[model samples]
Target: MTRKIFKQFFLALVALLSVTFALTTLATADTSNLAAENVDITFGTTVDADLPAGSLLKLNQPAGAIYPLHNSTGKLLSRGIAGDASTAPSLTTDQIKLDVQSGNVYYQVLPDCWLQSDSTVTLLDSTGQAPTDPVALTLKFVDANGKEIQDAKTFDAQFSTTTDATTLATLETELLAIRPAVTGYNLVSADQAEHVITYHYAKPTISTGSTTVATQPSDPVTTTTPIPAKTEPVAVKGTAIYATKKIGLYTSPNFSKATRKIWYQKKQRQNRPQFVVIGYAKSRSGQLRYKIRDINHHSLTNNRRGYITANATYVTSLYYHQNPKKIQVISGHGLNAYQAVTLHGRKLHHYRKGATLEVKAVKTHGLTTRLVLSNGHYITANKTMVIKR
Candidate 1:
């Protein structure tokens, strides 16, 4: 019996040690997985240039890709215009461009500077003046083998008369003497920036130069890094009310002479606010204005959306009305869509006196309590129009 017990204990001890070794090996295993071990890059102000983990980058548009330019007011500045088609400067479809775009801050070349002219390319307003000569941009790079790259990249603002740069990488020129365009950034003053590009290569990979495999100690382990997701747009919150002792609507935020009259005059000073504010903007003079509307009513003015002077109106936090409930139109006829809750107002649609419309909410303006519809049009909640179902 003693001998049998000793044998069983010895076997159990070996099993335990094997399990312990397996667990220890798993605990020390490397999780980082990297494939481009021999590729690297660096750039920007004096910092070492290396691509952020888990990003792919490509430079320059493929040949045969054409892009058009536009003027400030948004007119196409085509290639064939006002003579100088053969001599006027323009970027070819194959012009070299560099854009550093990993995530949201995508550096893209814009055509904001180029202008249209009858004779020559003009300067962009952003660039005070355009230069006659093509700008000079510096470019440097090294391959994966750590060797200087020659003729791999080149750039020019315009054709040089003193030297021949026709065979170079980029040929950029102004449109009718205007500051020309660059990718991912704007020109300084009225001239193009002498952008400096430098590239750093990675260490070369070791090779046996033979078909047969060479013995290696072990493969290095690596972990995979996940890319972050992009963010979505959120809707604006809060509500704006248009109410006061007296109200006058204007064509613009400046309260310009062009007026959009919505009558809401109360004899007594009361906080009877109407209209929900939807948007905010500034006029040319920079006065603040709010986009408010008595939704479901006939919109004020000649337009469907109306704006009011925020400072002159009583602005308040959003107040939720009762949830939409179904109701029947038990009486009345001829309910015209008024631009507002008032009985005397602009007409939107002339409908028969009795029609079943969902009442989304109830809003009060002075003595009138209007039934708000899902589409933001309002109808009077008077006995002549609706009754409880």
Candidate 2:
């Protein structure tokens, strides 16, 4: 009985050990599949490819040839042993060379992605060691077949140590201070190849203050003073005479017994008598008679009663007494040869030169002269030369 129990216990221990080993193998297999190995594919030194873990890449084979890319755990990254010439297996020639000629590389996080840098990118590890995890990367190039190439990978291994929190904060503050600069971030890409235009809003400002000034008032209104009007002086009434001869001022009428007398004698016979007036008068027949005053009288007798020259007497007053000694005569130029005779206190005389002088015997036609006497007698004289006083 002891021998039989020992055999059964042995078998049971063996079975338990076998089951634990299988389970361990299965877990190890799963863990190994989770960590895929990196694959290096080189078309040429100029042609480069980068493959990350947990990704699928495609490769195209030459006609009638087959190739495969696999991880360290024997999982196929690309499949197809050999393909038809018309549809050969293809490998992506797309790759990007970082720090090709220069030592700096730049990239921008696309929209909906997280950024790892500000303006620069640097290759470094989190623990200050070489990079251990595979990085998801993309390259831009044209293949030998002129086909556009890109990496087919998904990973979270891309990192950069150049991102500065202080710089980002400072940039954000400066951008906010810029009136319209924040909108430009949407306009340019990391490569500065893309642009997005947008509008910005702003506000206006103004200043207000006070000032002092000097001013003056206006002048008062003026009033005009009125002036008194002047009156014209009154004119007095008087007489103005326009005379043609030497007129006299007399004190009486009737020249025979006048207080003063004026006579034309000697050389005065050629001049017109004083107060000579040419006008019309009323005759005895009551008709208009044209008359001349201060005319030369003829001496036909020793009396003043002699025939008046036709149309020679005017009825207006003759002023002959103002200058008594002023004589006037028509001929025989002397005053002493004439006589003065009075007829009842009226002078009536004529010129006489050795002839009998009588009122009834006076001749009507003869050479005569007029002599003005100091006794107020105007007599006619014959053959006598009158003197002027």
Candidate 3:
């Protein structure tokens, strides 16, 4: 069983491990082109937990022909001849027929698709704290094209402590959990039940009336890239602005980017993460990003390293509020922005009230509504009637 990828979804019943399985480790089974058999696949958990004794798993809708591995008697091993330790997988006759297509021969051994039922999920912030609302909410299987396959499957029973069944009902025979909260990340795989599959190709020897000749192995016409590479969370460090101690920082100059955390405070020596920036990155439209770092870093292999992108983490200053941009006209009178965030500092611009302008991002300080103008200027958003920047 290879490591399955688990998108930061909260699931206490099963853990998705995106473990990269080494293909070189498995010894190839002998191939017989004339009589290759297909192993049937089914699904069930080996864990002897408190699940209902006979609850079944099914998909919300039929997207593809998916069968989970069974867990009744024991794990069905790959099939082979004597001295061949591989156990044969159980498959329906229909799948076996499909396996023997016009250009390929199927094998009797199927990949492992065992489902364990002991893990639970908890959505954690980068700081290891749960969000005010549940963060990791959606979980499902997807095709390699990044489209969801089906709705969450259900069981015959409504699972509550008092419901007829206490076991989980899953759909698609797929084994991947997804969290859509994270931006710019997607879970894409055509893999079935999240199992790594291997196929044995066999070329038959045609015995003509008076000739004996060998043919090349059949081409794999229907094979597909079934698994996505693991994506580890990254740690970023940012420099603080304003020598006074801390200022807002962001992953990028984009106002919509998230604010990075200040992991440590030298003066306090506590784990309190303050939203602050360390330094600035390149700016565009007068918007700049603050460099930031992850407080705790995960150890990685494959010569892996972590990075914060213009889209991932950032500093949150008054100039870099976490809001999307909007263009509007300064519509009211006596409206303006203050440099000190209070109603007391000099204005960054002298735009007349009711003037049309583009508001890049917004931040509210006390009674002031600061706005970043399209011409690289600042003003209060109070009078703006977005005219589309």
Cα RMSD (angstroms) for every candidate in the order listed: 30.3, 73.5, 25.7
User: Which is the leading candidate under TM-score?
Assistant: 1
Candidate 2 achieves a global lDDT of: 0.25
lDDT of 3 at 153: 30
Off by over 4 Å in 1: 1-240, 261-263, 267-273, 296-303, 318-389
Return whichever of 1 and 3 wins on lDDT: 1
Q: Which 10-residue window in model 2 sums to the lowest lDDT?
A: 232-241
Give the alpha carbon lDDT tens digit for every residue of 1-389 in model 1: 69999998875665445334423532443211111111111112011011111121121223222233343233455421111223222221111112211110111122221222212333221122233464445444444454554333443433233332321112111110112122222222221234444433332234667544433324321111111112311112123343545665553455654656455554221224355443344455655565444542443332234456655434432232343365456444556666676646677776564566777788865424677777777766654245444
Better of 2 and 3 by TM-score: 3
Model 2, 1-389: lDDT tens per residue?
Answer: 69899998875565445334423432333121112111111211111112122221122223333333233233344322232234311211111111100111221111111112121222332222333442232222222343323232122223222332222222222121111112111111111011111122221223445644322224321111111112311110010011233333221121233522333232232333322222122223433321223323443211111111122231222222122244344343322322333222432444432322212122211112243455444443222222233
- Model 3: weakest 10-residue lDDT segment is 89-98
Greater-TM-score candidate between 1 and 3 = 1
TM-score attained by model 3: 0.18
